[model samples]
Target: MLRSAARSYSTKIRSAVRVPNESYIKDKKVTFDRSFPVQKRTKAWEKDGMDKGEWFKKNYAHVHARQKSERAINGDNDPFDKRSKHYERIKQEGSYKREQFRNHRSEYTRAHPLQGLKPNPLIDYVYGTNSVLSALLAKRREYFVKVSHYGPLNTQIQSLCNKNNIQVEETEKHRLNLLTNYGVHNNIVLECKPLQPPELSHLGVVNSEGSTYDKVEMDYDQSVNTRDKFMTKENKKFPLGIYLDEVVDPHNVGAIIRSAYFLGADFMILSHKNCSPLSPVVSKVSSGTMELLPIFTCAKPLQFFEKSKEEGGWTFVASHLSGSKSKTHLTLNELSGMLNELPVVLVVGNEGNGVRTNLLNRSDFTVEIPSGRNPEEARNTIDSLNVSVATALLINGFAN
Candidate 1:
């Protein structure tokens, strides 16, 4: 039995083992062969009076020459080689900068942030706040809309002064701070002015043809009062509107405004912390959409929504992906068709996390933009689209 088991084991081992493939062995050894082709020196090493390795090491002049020639072929320069002309050019740049700084001899430099930067030609223009206000003011005498989150309309007020070539009494104290915060140098030639007081009865008037209006001041003391100028009228306010729930990206906010304005949507309500539509980047990205819309700022978003409800506004929230029911995924065109024809408020939530539960609970309807494919292979690369892209999709959908 022991002899039979030994024979069986030997047979099993013979069956399991096989000769290695020649090609595999050859390929595997290619790296080692390339580095060291032969085991011993040939006639070339013997003539040099050195072993193969010694000959290769001692005659590195040829290797260096080959490297230099190959570098030239590949358009590469020796970084440490000062004799190279390219090295001198880089050195000159360094020396020139030092000299330039020495000549200036000051800690603060005159370099403007926008000095070398080019704004988008298609989107950006030389229109100052004063210029826009003046143009709008002069074009029609009937209406001029002024919306502000912080202070009163400085840009428009300044623009009006410039158009009329009159200096405003009010110097822009905080305006400079705002511009600096946005990294925009306060290099604009601005003319300041005080806002004309509103009339006792009428706050503003609307024009029929040009759709322009001017301010009508009410009875007030000499004090500069901001409370007299809330843009919303409790009675005449649009029944439905959207509130920005911490949508901080100004570009997204502006795009959303543009979308909302075009969709026959009434207004946008934003928290004080959220970016203003009048911000330079936002205005540029919105492509002048800021002119057509009105936005209101409130202390708290939920409180604002509650007040809106009290004033007869219905809130509709765009729900997030977590077990939230969106009627169906419809393209912009499809969403426009399904939207409520009556007065309504559309709420778009935060970018990463959707609407807060508290806000969602307050919403009359939780709408969502559908995604994924079929019911099985569903996934999204980004949990949601850019706020601006989503806003455009939302607004365009409800446009009809």
Candidate 2:
């Protein structure tokens, strides 16, 4: 009886549904994310803020102001015109002096270095804004500035020259590219006096003690110039000097001068042979420290070292390689034991091959920077430190 009832229920369910095999209906539409309409919405905070049109002006106010200043200098708007308010504001505010900081040099003429050492002009080009500005303020050279016809920089060049008497020439923008020799001149070019290499012999007293020294021959004018320029607060004090033996790279030479001067060395002696000249690059690299450093050339460095020891009581020290096997070898720390010995000369050598073997032999004591690394690592390391770096380390450790 239960089986018959179940069969009747199944028959009823089968009769209620239609079979697919008999027929098919139309296809339904398919929808993808790309087909959906985008919903536009705005955040409550952003709703009251800046519009798209005002965004550029607000965000780039400084850039626009700079451009405006340039236009005034370029004759774009009357505001940027030569005598415009933009230029006048700088004059009133004395903003040009921004580049002229700590400029001790006034209008007084620099005593020309001795006749033979009169620096022959090397290159006419002076790049970088600070360099040209320093050269002008230093009054170290006569500069003829080339600038774009009309702009803020040109206006600055014009204003600086007008007061200081540097000659400024206006040229088309394209000319600066040619003038600076494709270097990054930033649209300004200046031709100033070349770097002057002073003669070594004329630098200071060839002989400290008149009885033991042979005077360097010089006329009245040369004597006056030498006295005026090289004579300084420290020159007359007890002697402390540094001798660079053929450390030729200009960057190194400039950097060493800065380090030597700041570390209280009274003066510097640069070798004429295989040494970098006193160029604008060196001058600028020294952060204008070259201007302050009392530099002298050494035609005979070995003789000068010998004289410093024999005649003057200057201690002759050097930074030679560690374990040099020389009898005078001492670590940098050991130098402190000898500071009671005042007058000293620190000698640093060339980049490739250090102080000549003869120079190393002449040193009163050879100081070495200790190798901090383990023995095995030290073996695979570089043989020598950079000439500039070694000079700085030696200077910092130098006895006052």
Candidate 3:
């Protein structure tokens, strides 16, 4: 019976491979012209394809009628109207083609599993009918928002969500599986903010809450610990304050955060206006270190610095290239001698500019790195090290 089954399978495979003889016209000598056409001028067409008079008789009437219709509608052959129509047609065609391509690609990707391709995140927060975006802004101090309600570009967000374990919620009518658990009260709502800000505009109509009271719930107040409570946490060692001037590079920020976390720095603080905290780029670069680090942003960096200093901590600058015999120039042993008594707060500044003068003056000490023979050459080339590399050096130096 097994041998008979095998023979039957082989026969079926052979039959499936067979093609009908009528599919190819024997007289055409297996020509590709029917399958795929290539444009060319034939000898007959080259020799007087068709007489001008005959061509005019056949096609001129239709051409003239079209021109007359154009004149009747637009009063002249301006060409702009035709151009606009042409562009519109092209745009529609392009859109259709793109949509078809996307569908095919999506189907292909769904069929084939790739290890590197990230999975979609579960929805931690969902907005329907109510101003969920507005609520997010109001409670910005509480939660580390992973994705903003930018628009329907959730795919980009999905990659990040998968990496950091974030949740996504949508209020579209078709989607029956609404994330109503956790802080989400209900996805059903009627009267919500119809418009959203440029950054958070995606949540405007796609998913809105009908009842205002049900939609305004916030997770930050429940999730994060209060300042006093956070302070009282057991073994809260090395609560060093970090102040960023204009460090916009998220990768650098993430690396610095990783260094701080590993070197026993418990907390980090940033300038509220100048820096972005809990951004996806930073999260990805840090590789889950952001979750470990307690990040705080203050309105006034200088005031925060002073407060940290007054709390038995010493503020020091890491940039040693500045003129004058700055403590920034001190060796690890020398620096350790200075920091042994006081809780040290190390300040690494922006990529282009070093720390500001006012902050520099107030700092307890300024340290510098030793340079090459020609001080000018060293100073010029000294700008080459990445902020992350410099951070590693500074953190390891302090920990050692």
Candidate 4:
């Protein structure tokens, strides 16, 4: 009796539910394969070993003809025209603005080819608090164009500018940043003519006349007189000048200059070629010492050395690395002792390569700073000091 009741209940449930036929279900069902077929794609030009331009022309000649015909029909040949089909296609590719900008830039560049290519030779933007203040105090530049500060101007700077009749403008920091090319401006910037150092031949003139060195351009006769005066001075100062040989880094140059000036060196000499320029960055790095220091340029270094040795009896002492095959004739102590006997020009060399072969050979004395580190321990590591540091040490040695 129970089996019969369960069978009747199952029959009623099957009748209540609507079940689809297997054939109908099969007709509605869909299947997708999980695996994707991978194929290698090769460019037609690469496969045919033909030039890309030739292949493009051969395959897309019909497309080009069609485009030309459409362009003619639309009466527009300009690629930059907003209504042109070419411009519309570029817009679809999301390069419409880029193409427009590029077109405008090319036109502008062609119209003014050298607009920003060269910097203003006559002017320089001196920045940083120390650099600006020092420049104002030194009055090295020919004329002060103006002074601009992001915040309240320093009282000293303001007074100096007012006395010199220089214009002062309160400006935003971003403007100062732009003027200094994002250098460490310290909220102040100065506009003025660049400092123009006289040639190396004017060393005697610079030594004799203090601040008016630039004003007196001596001829050969007057230069000789000045040289005699410098050499035969009663006080016997025996000025020691620092010569930079291919020191390309401006920071190193500035540091060396500052060190030389602070250590009582008479003047600074720079090789005309392969030496860093006296840029505003150098001036700032030197903390305005560059403005105060008297600098001279030597166009032909070897010739100048020879002439100075013969005529002025100046000694050339070169700095070299230790543990080298080249013999260092004198140590720093010995050099210091000899400083009083002769007028000396200390030669510091390039960062990577030491003093040039010819200059090294020409030097009367080659001095190397003795290292404190053990030779065996420090052999693998950096053994030489930076050019600027070495220069400072050497200058201090000379001064003492």
Listed in order, each prediction's TM-score against the native is 0.44, 0.54, 0.43, 0.64
Evaluate candidate 2 by giving its C-alpha RMSD to the native, one decimal.
Answer: 29.3
Better of 2 and 3 by TM-score: 2
Per-residue lDDT tens digits for candidate 3, residues 1-400, read 9999999898777564656486555654665676896897665323667866776667578877777788778766653468778899999999999999999898755231213333334223333322233223333223334433323533433554455454554445323222222122233211112111111000011011121100011133432212211121122223344556567787788788877777656356565566655543454456546655655555555665564455334445554455576434555446543323334556777776767777777777666555445656644745436766766676666555
Clashes of 1: 19
The candidate that achieves the highest TM-score relative to the unseen native structure: 4
Selected candidate, larger lDDT, 2 vs 3 = 2
The models' CA-based lDDT, in order, is 0.50, 0.63, 0.49, 0.77
* Worst window of 10 by summed lDDT in candidate 2: 209-218
- Stretches off by above 4 angstroms in model 1 are 1-163, 166-240, 274-277, 323-341, 372-380
lDDT of 2 by residue, 68-152 (tens): 8887777675543566766789886785575364354543334332222334454456655655665556665544544333245
Q: Show the lowest summed lDDT stretch of 10 residues, model 1.
A: 194-203
Question: What stretches of model 4 exceed 4 Å from their correct place?
Answer: 1-119, 202-236, 322-328
Models sorted by TM-score, best on top: 4, 2, 1, 3
**lDDT-sorted candidate list, best first:** 4, 2, 1, 3
